[model samples]
Target chain A: MATWLLLTLAAAAADFQDQDKQGHPTRAVLLGGSGEAHWNAGASVGSPWTTVTVQRGLRGGWTPLAEVQAASFARWQPAVGVGKRWIDRRWRLTGEGTVGWTLQGDPIPFRGPAAELRVKGGRAVGRFAPYLHLGMRSSRTEDRVETVSGDILREEARWETTLTGALGTGFLLTDRVGIDIGLDLPWVHMPNPSIPGMHIGVQTGWGRNQ
Target chain B: MHTHGVSMVRTILPFAFLIACGPPPKGVDYRGTRLAVVDMHLHPGDWQQVPESTQGYLASRFPFPFGLRPEQVAEGVLTGEAILDQLDDAAVSAAILFAVYAPRTVGVATNELVLRERRADTSRLWGLASLPVDRWDESSEAALAALSEALDNPGMVGIKLAHAHMHFRMDDPAYFSIYDMAVAHDAPVYLHTGTSPFPGTRTEPEYTDPAYLEAAIATHPRVQFILGHMGYDFIDQRPGDADTAIDLAVRYDNVWLEPSALGSRGSDPTGTNLPLVLKKAKTAGVEARLIYGSDGPQSPGFAADYLERTLTALEAADYSVEEAQLILADNASSLFGIPTFKAEK
Candidate 1:
């Protein structure tokens, strides 16, 4: 399926102009959903995690994003981030960072403050772009979720981390609209880690913002 | 662009349908040995009652993920109908549903809900009563009264306790009276006997060690104690108390070793430890004392996957067919008196 999609995308790219090199940077707002299967993690520990994201593309290749992730809708983690992108004929690359909060759920012992850093790269043809993303995410969990809202008397904590990656293609419907779809690959807390997942996103923007 | 967008939807729709409509779960094929399955450990909860942490965990347990919010999906699956549908999908003959009251951790799935669900009429669902132990000193009497009442009902087979999640110590003599209640009711006790990853659970040996309950096991010999998770420490990711649990089961006849959650990817990615534990039980000639519990329904098809995982582990341990039957179905049936299943001739 992936091979067929990539071949089609390559064929489409051949007919389109390199607007990435000639036109202005994209400034768009995006909304999307993501899902990952953690059955491989541990039946008790891994929940089919689904996440929703909202993003704002800023001027001069800067972007800000926010998201809420749910582990089977049982737990929720919300995060905010910013990234910078560099585009050319062959690749559209981005580097981003974010901090996430485990607001409620079992926390079993405590909640979490998680941090992530990611990089994405892709190429565009006409309105289609296929990208690959790679990064790292880390979090601390224990009894009390450290938050801005409350006081903590004592904290017992541990660290968890994962290597994050994704492969997807984006389609620009018009000068102001587009969609992105991909598979997310994360190696969580390795020796053993999590498996690949899926995400879909939609966006609208002012094109060629010179 | 509109055409392209339409095309994109058309392309993705098939994938969505595929996820929504998964292949019917073809449950564990017992080869030639006809073995019925009774899943001893499962937690059920309401969407509103579940803590966000638990809600997150519940979201992905099912096989499908589309057309609804994650919580909405969980809310749907938590229902009696959905539970039964899931059970059918996994080919589970019957299941034991636990009533959870750990508000600080997983949240509540009340005893009343367990009894109220219509699934009880189908005989596919059974109950394990859980009491509110967070306020032990203040409400122990009322809690026991409620528990006793719950146990009096049909299909209420056991008492489920989590020393770690309920913020209690196993050896706290003050709480040991609960065992006396177990003795009177003829209900077996299922205790969470190892470190849990859930926040707020007590991880110390006092709370999690299977050895901590030896005295209680001895004192209440009439009351059976089924050690849950087989002292598998999920947080530390080691076989935390498997040896102690196996030792206790070997030493004490009233104790039953339950190796639940040992087959999970998070606990044992290589599928290594459970087979060893099974081998140890067979070696010790304690297979009859072993009861099978998947600790599942975690993700949609997990109950079936866990059963298959466990049965595979049984094969890995080289457990003979008779030992497998004892561990898989016979032991649970002997204790609960649930009706039996004979494989089709």
Candidate 2:
């Protein structure tokens, strides 16, 4: 995901020809929500246990664009793929779609290639912005349950998906530096191993155009 | 002339735009202002249980009640649901969880299980793995290998050792193996010094003396040592016998004191007696050397409440608020390498 994010950013930079009237690409640092990925808990009876998606936007726009990401948790393995973004800057609206394969890590019920969508935006206060996001995500999960007689009776695996939402605020310190605090509803489903539910994290990047 | 003017205008344009943009509004320090319950000593309770499935197949199992099964014999053991309920009811945001079994005796199986559980529950659980200090014959090699294995695990944030269980003094060359291991891991060691309960426990009131640790610290300059039980003698001994322990922790730059059994179980071991230790830590000007710890199952319900009460009692006994915060959170965070308590904007 990082490699692809960087590549896309490089492509964006190559696109910026430094035209005389281009206004220097509006280089403002972004410390806002990355709604490109929506985390979901196992709500469906036959879905993966947990799913996590981390992605970045190489450029800003209101139309769908290409992206890369890795999704995993439980039996699910980390997968990399191409994605698209949809944005409506006026009301701070944004959405994303991605497809990738399970690259590495533990693999079980999970299969290759996953997809996601997110909508977000609120009020932008100069260098800081607060946003709300809602999204749906899908993946696969697997487990090993032993028998009473000490035998491996069965391996349970399934492709699952969930709906998630979060509220967050971020600071755009410079064209390349930013920070964000988000509260995500880890699992929207029941009967799943409760892990990595609600998380608070900070991310910093350099050479980010969005 | 026109091109020169344009270049100058471009330089000023970005500056003018930045000035017009102004600065971002400052957010409140939510964590600092909030009343957080800091339980210093806690363990991932379920991991203590011997997995029934793992045991059922065996012809004979270790006599120890392993697994989540609760027996009336011990007040500290709790079921999985009950353990979660305690935190849910307490509004606790942080806890320092440590393993109780001597790593050398209990082996890595139990410690490994505990670490896995703590990693899965990071927000409320900070796990300190037990170091294998029971085997003193080859103390250095055993300590190094055992601690290295436990510390290599990312889930393991710190090292835990009990002088009583290991039968080694903090100063003994035999135990320096553990110190060397902890230094290599870049994590803190929660040394079980001061006092213990079991009869014939190696750390007697005299040998458990905190001074023993000074030379070790001098030799192992990089190790960060946390004195457990507030330096209180474990078995019945003279009152305030841990004075030397307190003095050493206060005097040493690397030594730390955790309010574990001291505030709840010690020479006068009771919830009420906790304040005295806090007072001593303050009077000694080593308040900042103290950190939070529960020594659970060893004590009762006071772990969650002691942190706040200890601070209040210290102040009532003439300690400063600054001293209280240092003991409750700041020092522990610094000593244990807990990034959560670091200052940030």
Query: TM-score of model 1, chain A?
Result: 0.64
TM-score, each model?
0.68, 0.47
Best by lDDT: 1
Q: Across residues A1-210, which tens digit of lDDT does each residue of candidate 1 receive?
A: 999999987765554444332221221221111111100000111234566555554556566777776654644668898766655345556678889875443322236798988877766555666767788888887744455467776667777676777676766654444566667676653543254566666544332332
Native contacts present in candidate 2, fraction:
0.00
Error of 1 at B243 (Å): 2.6
Writing each residue's lDDT as its tens digit, candidate 1 over B200-289 gives 567889999999999899899899999998899888677878889989988998999999998776678788888888888778878788
Each candidate: RMSD to true structure? 10.3, 19.7
| Weakest 10 consecutive residues of candidate 1 chain A by summed lDDT | A34-43
